[model samples]
Target: MLAHSEWKAAGEQLENQPVAGEQAALNQYAHLVRRVVAHMRSQVGVVADRDDLQQIGMMALLKSIRRYGRSLDEQFESYAFKSIRGAMLDEFRRLDWRSRQSRKEAHDFRDAVRELRRELGREPRDAEICVALKISERQLLNMRYLEQAEVVESFEMLLEQQTHFVDSNEDIEQLEVRQLMTQTLALLPERHRILLQLYYTHELNMKEIALTLGLTESRVCQLHKQSLQLLTEKLKG
Candidate 1:
């Protein structure tokens, strides 16, 4: 909840020119964005800069402030929370889609894959798909960028799974999600499973996890990403 003075100041910023209170509000939300981005860095790939995500979240927070009004049913904080998170996720999706091939090209590739799979009676190899599509391997890999959602888990993958297990009308206290989570974690490789346990359950930072695993911090981060990706796949399956 925002303080009374904070709300008043935010309203003034919305009405005035120099964007009063924006800097202060953004400064406060900066911590919020960092937490969100840190959580997301594991879910999404670490390819994006942390600063890039922070900038997108700031933009969304500003937009939320601009659009907010008392006429709406929800409080400003609730609105802003959604705006900030949604903005970051939307930016991630935009980055993913920017490399998309044309609709015709995507469809052609999918058709080629289907045909080759039918002919082979099994999943077509990348080379077979390329030959069937009459495209080089590079082009096939490029097409993969457009089809990331098929191969890699999207950011909302965990959120969707949570919704399925913890609905408004469900039984059992809270062990349901934990049980599911444990089951999924167990499916990962031993190193990955240990890494997740060390970082998450133990609350160790990346640097600490790296030292514990006898790997570099950056390598630990990469392993974190791969582990989550594998866990997401297991959960979805």
Candidate 2:
């Protein structure tokens, strides 16, 4: 076992002799690898392999060691901890990016909502949205149609995007945002609410929703888009 005393000595040596410090840190490989595995398991759940996490974590750990400085305001462990976790998170994002929908269309939809709110001081009707965006109702509907087809994320996934203000730790901001969204969701029509529940809460695909709701897949898709459009405007208010 590498002692805390040894860790301190190696950290101090790193100031004068970086190679020696790096070798010393290697003596404590088990400790660093364990910390990395803990971070991976938290974000990715239990299926993650120890060897894979260890390999990624070691790369991050080495980078941290190389960049760490005695002149910094924080301790070596604190700095290295962030580096290791950030590395793992980047890998996780890369893997998940395949299915990750573009937040752009969703964001643009919200922006249009906000503009209507500012101009009208209330939830603008679809016609009003058409005027505010300077497009005809059919064009606006087309925009929504395209957005709906492009949207692969469910309501729950959207919620996840919103609440990610929570960061690495829980805070009052996360709680407040969640509470507000809960209220906003409740205000939606019963049928619209159900659509959100099936897609986001139940994590169902469009085909599954069509089967369960006894509607055609195209109808379900339209409903999904219409519901989000309504909710986005209402939330803006």
Candidate 3:
């Protein structure tokens, strides 16, 4: 979170020479850049280059301030946070962080689980999947985590698109979509709403959200999926 004084200083600095002000703003918000990069790295695992991600985040932050052209406040912070994260996600998409081998392993893991479920005539247990796949429970958990991360990432991409739509244009169709999304969100369960807010608005990752809500990260992931499903179904209705 940015302090009031920091925001004030950043706003004052940005009123000066453009290049120097941008640098000053970046320096003032360097801590925020680091925090966002750290959170992204945790989500992305070791495959992400921290230095590159931080550079992306810093650039996004600078762009955000210039684009906003408003007083530095809580609204600016929220806007900048989303901008920074969206830029990082764009970089990740460009990099294709998941290796071919990792994708193949994930595909195999899913196929094995599906086969076991069909053969058993029920959803296979974690222990069963581990045995059938010749993987340890921890490995199975990691696979599941990757799957969950994919779902979360997909939802975040949708959100990033929506944010762009809102920012770039406020056409009638977009307004209607925004209204419907608001209504759909309002209909969600209280816990689901909070989880969505924490993740999307507050920009906390699943692990941090798990600690805050006193639930396991896996449960948070499931609830996240469930919440998105409910929103989708409601919007369709």
lDDT of 2 at 222: 61
User: Candidate 2 on 1-237: residue-level lDDT in tens?
Assistant: 889999999886665443766767745544655655543332333223567767777777776676754433446665566567567756655555323333465467768878778888876676677677788765655444445633422333454555545455433554655586678879999999898777645546566777999975545656887887777666656
CA lDDT of 29 in candidate 1?
56
- Model 1, span 120-215: residue lDDT tens: 999766667667778886566555433433333352556444645535532342356557768778888999899878754564656677788787
Question: What lDDT tens digits, residue by residue, belong to model 3 across residues 50-113?
Answer: 8878777887888887887777777677667767877888887777767788668768877887
Clashes of each: 0, 0, 0
| C-alpha root-mean-square deviation, candidate 1 | 11.0
Best candidate, lDDT: 3
What does candidate 3 score in Cα RMSD to the true structure? 8.7
Clashing pairs in 2: none
- TM-scores for the candidates: 0.42, 0.35, 0.67
Candidate 3 backbone collisions, by pair: none
TM-score, model 1 to reference:
0.42
Candidate 3's TM-score: 0.67
Q: Considering every candidate listed, which one attains the maximal TM-score?
A: 3
